[model samples]
Target: MPSSSPSAGFRSGLTASLPITLGYLPIAFSFGVAATRAGLGAAEAVFLSLVMYAGASQFLALALIGTGAPLAVSAVTLIAMNLRHVLYGPALLKQAGADARKKHAWAWAFGLTDEVFGTTLGVLARGQHRFSERFMFGIGLGAYASWVMGTALGAFAGGGALEGFPTLDAALGFMLPALFLALLLSVLRRAQLPLIAVAIGTTALVSWLVSPVAGIFSGMVAGAAIGMIRAPRATKGNTA
Candidate 1:
């Protein structure tokens, strides 16, 4: 059953977020170093993580700014890339069922990055924990804090911080995706395989032909469309 005590829920959520926190540290560190190298100051790099808080999008923003893409274009591209995030709340809440409280959602929802959402959903889907807004808040807070901390350290460390550790630098780039993928596979079902495959293929194709940003957006659209079409069939099969 979902913990009714707010403190208990919060603590549990924080504990569960440990893995995400660890995963984010290196990646955020990488971003910080990259940012400074790209001409941003330590404070500026930290500000990006603090305010924007969009993992991949922040990197993309840095790229856009570095390349002298008009600020308007950069803004639009960032928004388009992260558009899929809009669906995360509804999907998570739906999985949480009617009993899941939303009174604190406005605050907690801000922390719902791809990894955080996947982690919470995995917990609920696996019956490891009942849905609690406080719990969600804890998870989000922990992950966010770690990310910011990592970014600060990296920024201060300067661009050459990882120069001696070439292998580590390369590995950091993969951590975000790898972490999310692990979370996803935890909740994977045979019925969802086709949707995942379609999304991956579309993303890869678009990215290869055009740009990574365009690919991500197209993949999201394709995945959502496929998911909606497949939902009914899955429901019917379950009922039958």
Candidate 2:
């Protein structure tokens, strides 16, 4: 049985975050290496991890900077890339419901990265443990720390550190997405299949026709629309 005690909750959350921390390390290291190779100093690379903290977007930022894109343009692009994050807090809190206790949400919510949100939601949906802000804190702290540490180490390692490990370099690209997909699958339900399919199709189509960024944004919008349409039907069926 899961304990509701604060200490237990924190410990459990920290334990649960181990997998995510592991996943983040190599990816963060990759980002750090990439950033440095693009001419950023180790401190600057680590600073990006500290403030931005966004996984893919951090890489995107490096690309934009490397290309000498205007600061305004880079800012807008990064914001657009991360707009999905705005919905994460509400989605999470809604799933947690009114009783989940969010007195510290303002702080812990900053750590609700894609992996963190998925892991938290999966745990909550599975009813493995009662919601605890302390748990959220623990999970967030573990992941954040690993990401920062990984960035620091990688930045110091220099860009050529992974040049000899072609296989590992290729594998890192898909690791985060694979982890997120697995987390989503853990909480998958039949009712969500259509939404997923639609989202995938929309994303693929837009990416082929336009740009990857457009594809991602369109897919999110399409999925949200589908989910909204299905909500009433799901609610009605449950009440029937």
Candidate 3:
């Protein structure tokens, strides 16, 4: 099938994003439940997913909010957590390029996340799918819709649904981590092992010695610095 056709592109993107959609359901649901349990109103929980659109950040925000963290602290925490995403935009923009980077680039930028980034990168890198706004929308919208639905359900239900299911309540915290792990493993590149190692080591060491928030930011900075230092300089006729 020609990936340029709107219908074909959307369908292909949707099909490719099914697993990510499924994976997001439970995690987002948990976020909703956690948000509500943390004293946020149902609308607030849903709005978090609607506006923030960042899964882990949503959870962290709710946690920070619940704990009475000041606005500045909450903002700083989220910024630290998402420092890694700074590296994703340039690469994705380069790959998707003109195909999806015209009038819709701003909207597309809002939809970029770890899973979406990985899926887009994998497809583009393999040249299996043509990049298009419709295709990217299909993938982003599917995941976004699923996440919103899950959030609404969990926000409304709260602990009521899991009252007797203690085991299920306990497992909610695990879902997001598992999802992130799966995405990370899928996107792992052999050539990036050294960078990955440095990031992980820094994260662990700083987390133990300082704070997890500091560790996350420090880890990404350390890894990025190492990557730049080890990067091969641009040469004649070489795009890399």
Candidate 4:
């Protein structure tokens, strides 16, 4: 189906978003339980999920809230962690209209969680162009709704629902790591694969000696520097 038709696009979007909805429910429910434990009211927890919309970052920020980590540190770390999306924008720069692009970019930046990015990238990789925005929006909206709903449900049930699902809860918590591993495996290009392995090893070493976050940032910077240094130079006539 051509992606240009609005109806077709909407369907494509909906289809693309299915994986995220499946994955987000339990995780979002866990977040809700955690937020309630942290003293946020039911409504407040839902509100945080709706407004912040970045699951892992929200969890990390909430975890650090009482640890005396300055708000600025949390904010900067979240921003830096999400900066990877800057790489996703150029590829999709063609699909969006001017105003829609701006709105999409802002929404995308705020909502750039693992599942959403993964779903969107998958949709694009399927050779669908015209429907990419609708597909992305569908995924984002589905995940967002699931997050809010899951949190609300969790808050309403309090501890009862959690008590009945211990093993499931543990599995849900591990989903993010599993998703990251899958993503890393998917993007294993020739040059990039070796660099990622080296970066991971270096980051592991630094994390044992220093802060995990700092180690991660340092490893990414080092890998990027190495990639640039080894990049092939363009011939003079190729510029035209």
Stretches off by above 4 angstroms in model 2 are 231-240
Tens digit of lDDT per residue, candidate 2, span 166-230?
Answer: 99999987888889789978877777777778999999999999988889889978977887888
Candidate models: Cα lDDT each: 0.86, 0.86, 0.78, 0.64
Off by over 4 Å in 1: 1-4, 231-240
Better of 1 and 4 by TM-score: 1
| lDDT of residue 16 for candidate 4 | 62
Best by TM-score: 2
User: TM-scores for all candidates?
Assistant: 0.91, 0.93, 0.82, 0.75
Candidate 1, poorest ten consecutive residues by summed lDDT: 231-240
Query: Higher TM-score: candidate 3 or 4?
Result: 3
Position 204, candidate 4: lDDT:
87
| Model 1 alpha-carbon miss at residue 157, Å | 0.3
Tens-place lDDT per residue, model 4, 1-240, is 446665666577667666667677777888888877766778877887887777766677677774668888878987766555555455345323341344455654555566666556544434454434555566667777777888788776664567777888788888767766765555445556546666887788887888676676767666656655564432111111
TM-score attained by model 1:
0.91
Give residue 79's error in model 2 in angstroms: 1.2
Candidate 1: tens digits of C-alpha lDDT, residues 119-148: 988888777777888899889999999999
| Model 4 regions lying over 4 Å from their true place | 67-104, 126-131, 223-240
* Model 4, C-alpha of 217: deviation from truth (Å): 3.5
Q: Give the distance in Å from residue 20's predicted Cα in candidate 1 to where it truly belongs.
A: 1.0
Model 4 has an lDDT value of 0.64
Structure candidate 1, residue pairs in collision: none
